[model samples]
Target: MHLQVRIDIQRRRQFIQIATFGVLLIVHQHHTGQADPDDHRLRVFYPRRPKAHRITEHMDRHLIVVSDVIEPEVEHVLSAGLSAFNDQMTGINDRQSLAVTVRNPDTHQVLGGITGRTSLGLLFLDLFYLPESLRGSGLGSRLLNAYEEEGRRRGCRSAVLYTLSFQAPQFYEKHGWQRFGEVPCDPPGTSRVFMSKAL
Candidate 1:
């Protein structure tokens, strides 16, 4: 009888330990917004459902604005969505980006730079910036030329970029880039000009 009692106690202890572990696991999942491995659906945990619903309703009613903060994960999701759409539309996904920087030789401080991607036989200049001190000093031209040369080496035939009306449209034109399109934008009279050049 004692042996049988001891066996029953052991079974009860094991069951309790497993039950406690299961509860803890569920609690952890609830707190961390982690879903079960078998569940492929995305999950987000909120402390209160009412608040979450209010926020969702606000987003549905208004233009979502998250003040000036850069959310890298959100950006990654957006980029991934576009890339997936592009891949679906075109079987060729040969897009590759390159960044070029100019720095002070002595201080190694970055002075100016350009970044863009090459795809579909074209180089898309996404971002280009040179300090006011370096503008019109021939450094901008050298940097632009070097980037185009690199793009040519990478099999890009044409290059395209955009600049605001108040920005470097004339600078790009002076570098042999031809204005191809203009998009009217905010603040009324201003526009964004698209330019391109054969590499």
Candidate 2:
């Protein structure tokens, strides 16, 4: 009879232990579920993009508009200063700085501006800035062709430039430039796309 009582106690203790474990598991699951009602953290997908050879793009020319704060000032200043400095080095102080300005043929008002440069025997069609309304017009194409002609005259073998992933990659591709490398941007998930074409 004592043996039977001890067996009963042991079975009862096992049952209590199992029940306690089940209750704890239920409470843990309930708390976890309550903490995140909308489970958005569990879903992510990474797609593979084409990889290409890495190239450190070197730029030698630029354009600047100091008065226009709405524009990219530092880029303009850097480009202008570099061009001026390079010209001074070559003993050619003439206004070789090419700033392509488009005007409305009817109103005679300036539409936009584009800048070009020659670096290390290569003409670089670096900076092209046009207002929104002027886009889709043939002005960009005209400016590019003119810039290439200038580059040819300057004896540059190639032209290179960079654009952000959010910007006009398709446009550059359409214009016979090929993508070479991309640098991932920090703090934001973006990339700088570099492209070049033989002149």
Candidate 3:
């Protein structure tokens, strides 16, 4: 009976530790939106409380996965898990969002723009789009330059992006981006071009 009581205590402590850490992670992420990064490992942090801890033993537990829908709570679970693991590994957290919006001159409705981020001294260009009306008017270059300039201001030393072969690879090259890698993608003869530039 004593041994059983001890085991119960240990299990309860484990559950409390896990639950407390999970809550801390969620609160941190909620306050500061972050994603996984290598330059800056996908990480999140909360106010100082304790040294980092780890769960070493693997547990066998039944699990159920629900799919085919977006759940904010589900996303928090994923984000917290990843951020915790990455934080444990790197002991560093430095990820930031960087985006530029293009809006209609007349109505001010958003047309398109660049979306990316800076982490660990590197700028990541995630998406860039300009409608047909704005493609060739030198605005694309301005936007690209703006994103890069802000990245530089944020201490990023380089920039990276991927573009489809049919999707303005030349436009990027014209802005001095170099193709470092390529992978065949959908649409015959087309490929995803990975490009990078030194800031």
Candidate 4:
């Protein structure tokens, strides 16, 4: 009985030592921002929640605007989120941007052009612009045709774009792009018209 009691005491001391060590290790990890591999609760209790909150607040307070400032780190984070979402939805996320530029041969100044991307069998025409001087000279048609050809070469089956009602909705229509929908803008007689064309 004495031997058993001594063994019980030793067992209780060992358990207390283990518990104390575990607590110390957890506290050390928490202080150092190092996660304990065996403890999933450490991540939850230590940095993940607070880090997530910080990220949420940072994102909430910031607005992404069209500007000259280039933030590569912020862009990478946003692009990663989009890529992950695209991957989850389609099981494939391949986005390749194509730019067609018209430049003066003598001065090498870029006048205007088209910029777009082909992803998941669809071409997204993000930007298309031409100078007023070059508008009626068939350059726009040539650029549009060249962009669509490149999209087809990249395995895109259809193309999509949006033009303001006051902008080149008629130009797209002239090029066989059919209007799919439109959203009215703030000012009267203006709307964002969505158009699509099959390759």
- Each prediction's Cα lDDT score? 0.70, 0.60, 0.71, 0.72
How many clashing residue pairs appear in each of the predictions shown?
0, 1, 2, 0
> Candidate 1: which stretches are off by over 4 Å?
1-70, 186-188
Q: What does candidate 2's lDDT look like per residue over 1-199, in tens digits?
A: 1111111122112111112223211001112334333332221112211122111232232222123243476679987998788788897643345566788889988877668767566666557878898788787788777787787787777888898888887887988889999999954888999999888
- Rank all candidate structures by their lDDT, best first, as comma-separated numbers: 4, 3, 1, 2
Best by lDDT: 4
**Full ranking by TM-score:** 3, 4, 1, 2
lDDT score for residue 1 of model 4: 12
- Span of 10 residues, lowest total lDDT, candidate 4: 1-10
Better of 3 and 4 by lDDT: 4
Q: Model 1: per-residue lDDT, tens digit, 1-199?
A: 1111111122112111112223221111132345344443222234322222122223323524333455797799999999889989998788898888999999999887999999878999999998888887798888888999989998999999988999889888888899999999998999999999998
TM-score on alpha carbons, each prediction:
0.61, 0.49, 0.64, 0.63
Instruction: Name the better of 2 and 3 by lDDT.
Output: 3
**Model 3 lDDT-worst window of ten:** 1-10
Q: Which stretches of candidate 2 lie over 4 Å from their true place?
A: 1-96, 106-108
lDDT, candidate 3, 50-120, per-residue tens? 22232223334322433456579888999889878877888867778988989988999999999998877
Q: Runs in model 4 with CA error above 4 Å?
A: 1-71
